[model samples]
Target: MIRIPTLRHVATRSLRCAARGAVQQRRWAQVHDVRFLTTQPSQAILEKYREKLSKKASQEGHGSIDDLKAAYSEKIQEQRKKDSTEGTPVSQPNAPSSFPPSKPAPKKASSSGEKPAIKPLGDILDLEKVAELPEKELTAIWRLRHASSPQTLCAVIPAPAYQAMESLARSNPYFVLPVPHESQGAEMHFMQWTFDPASKTSTVLFTQLAEYKARGEFAQPHTTVTHHLDLIKDKGLVLMQGQVMEGRNVQPDHAKWLVMCLQRFYGGWEQKGDELDGQRKERAEERQKLLEWFTNGDPRFSVEKLLEEAERMG
Candidate 1:
């Protein structure tokens, strides 16, 4: 004989069916509340891979994982540049790329989506017609010139700074040459300068004299560090520069010396300029007060009127 189902069994069977249907319906739409269930690699997984990469980089002669990554990025950049330049794909002998071949990776950008900076243009110098450029255009040309060889510019100090330093240096008949990180004990130094108004060029001689009658092996420029300054008056710019006479037999720390000397001169020049400006301002203010005092504090009368009255009385 067939048996009838109890009331509790019937309710339980309905609940089970409902749960199965819910699971089926919500499979794709379910929120991933668990941390590790996301598609992207977790922090721990990334760190684990980074460590493995570091080891591989060491074996492959890279200084660090960062170095390896930089080299790889450089190679890719070079490849892209080659393709862009030659209009053809070139086979690279370098190691294969880390990314999957099936999908092309997206270009990397800054958070603001700024375009990547291209390699700077170098080995270009055009002085002709550079003078006719307006101030803004001239500044552009200056930037390009500086960018091409920034290291060379460290040795180039402003003309104003050199003039200010020259005035101070002349106070002493003979002084020690200022070399960064070195001392010239008992040895004297001096400068001899000549200017040509026509060419607007100043030739400065930075001479080093050895100790009186106390001699060891003496090296040139015993008196030979020469600097040439060319003034561009029309553009309100000075093309002053100091250069070694020769490439050989120079100071071991020549680069450092140039940098330090430039720093000192620039600082002194700025300070002197500020002082001179302050003095002029103070004098003008005093002259204005004197005029006001004479005019019984009238706003209408100015220093010009006072001078005019004095000239009329004479």
Candidate 2:
């Protein structure tokens, strides 16, 4: 019984071996028998192969990698061909025209031996509006005129005085006092009020005889008083007084009295040779040289001489 069982086991093992050998032989036959192309494939053959791959993929219900790649390449080529053929010019936004025709140059002034016509003094004065400015502004305008020169109060007066004058001219049209000629011998003098005005202002401008002469060239001296008053009224009486005091580096009290003496001599009967009432009148006349020296910008006019002269007069 044991011999029979062993023989049966051997038979079963042999059958299993035979089945394995058959599978191995079939696999080797398949690998060896299948043929591959020996020559380089043509483009047409590759295309046909691609088509077959696509058909096979479609039948199997999925897209192949080669099929998708071929489709993408064809789309790109179509886009490039369309772009090359169309060649559209890009539209640009409108820009402003460069260098538009320039305006023609103005015609030159006629040289027909005709001088520019001068406007009348009345027209130049602008009097209707001139009358409206306050007295302080008028004083300022007069001060502005004399204060313009370097030899006069220009050296003594602060920069603000010049600025104030400029500001006054800009604000009030009447405050415009244009120096007519460069060579016009304009002289300016400052004076204080002895008998104060009803307005209680301490200072006034006293135009010298020289200024009077220039006044005759343009208009009467007294007629220009409106213009003068327009200057003072705008710049303010106290402001002028403060400037005089600051410029001279003197006490306001002394400067005030000195200015009064000036006003007395310039405004009073000194023009007529008639004497003023008090000893102050005589003293002011005696001090005329010093006053002229001060106005003339003479650096040599010593404080010693001024004090000595003051002592003699006193």
Candidate 3:
């Protein structure tokens, strides 16, 4: 219902904020997959905007959003050209559209001879086992599972799709999502993705603008939620983690709700998504073509191995 995929370009995420610093009558709420904490740490949101300038856009624009984007886009293209010229095998970039990585360690690959083949993600991966896979294996599995799923923002994207995402992210870096369920607290949230090239990780920030000024003398937006995303070492598996920054009497249910909303957001994009019959038909046709291609022994995806992995794990 949140339609988070509407701003699917950079895979924008929720934010974690610092709740303890405030003397006002507000509390903090944090949400993450593997961990939870009540003491609000301002690390997430503040870190993202640390580089933001306070003045009008500069022509020289050192550290300007547009400048940073142009530089990154050029660098991305350069990397692609380098890969092509040097005959580099396609892999996930060091910084995938500016995302990060983290989470529980995945299972170490075990030696097995007669493992079953891997299946599509819709077949339902053992989220637990999958979570424990080594970064490289996890990334490979992510690609194998979701490579052709329409509208997903995944690592190992096609050149064209990656370019499109870059264009969208650079041109419009943030998304303002209207939240009906959260309207009583805040009408809309300002969501942005901070891609850190230095650390090769990305952070998603969700800020709820306080309708009125804060209770303190210096007024500020009431809520800030932050999430950190990372790509597995080389294969580029994504790790989605978050912590809530502000709220009152927040319960564990709130964290669950936030996670579900984010999961749905990454599931789709565009208004129609894959809802229409025509779109579904087209998707099915394309998938069939891929199946045919793989059936004939396409080397792109180690289909057999993936199937083996899927079957072994599932």
Stretches of candidate 1 above 4 Å error? 1-128, 134-175, 180-190, 211-232, 245-248, 252-268, 275-314
Best by lDDT: 1
Give the alpha carbon lDDT tens digit for every residue of 201-299 in model 2: 222232222232233111112111111122233433222322222232233333333333333323222333445678756665545544444444455
1-314: candidate 1 lDDT, tens digit per residue: 11112222332333354456654322212111111111222344336578897888999999986687666764453343222222111122241232112222235454546333221111112234444456555444343333333122212344566665545434321222222112111112222333434333433334332221121111223222222233234444443323333343334244334333333322323434555577545544443343334324335533233222222212
Shift of residue 64 alpha carbon in model 2, Å: 92
Q: Which residues of candidate 2, in runs, are more than 4 Å off?
A: 1-227, 231-258, 261-273, 276-284, 292-305, 308-314
| True-vs-predicted CA distance for residue 207, candidate 3, Å | 1.6
> Each prediction's Cα lDDT score?
0.34, 0.30, 0.32
Please estimate how well model 1 matches the true structure, expressed as its whole-model Cα lDDT: 0.34
**What is the Cα-based lDDT of residue 127 in candidate 3?**
45
CA RMSD per model (angstroms): 33.8, 51.5, 20.0
Q: Give the per-residue Cα lDDT of candidate 3 at 285.
A: 40
Q: Could you tell me the lDDT of residue 307 within candidate 3?
A: 24
- Ordered list by TM-score, greatest first: 1, 3, 2
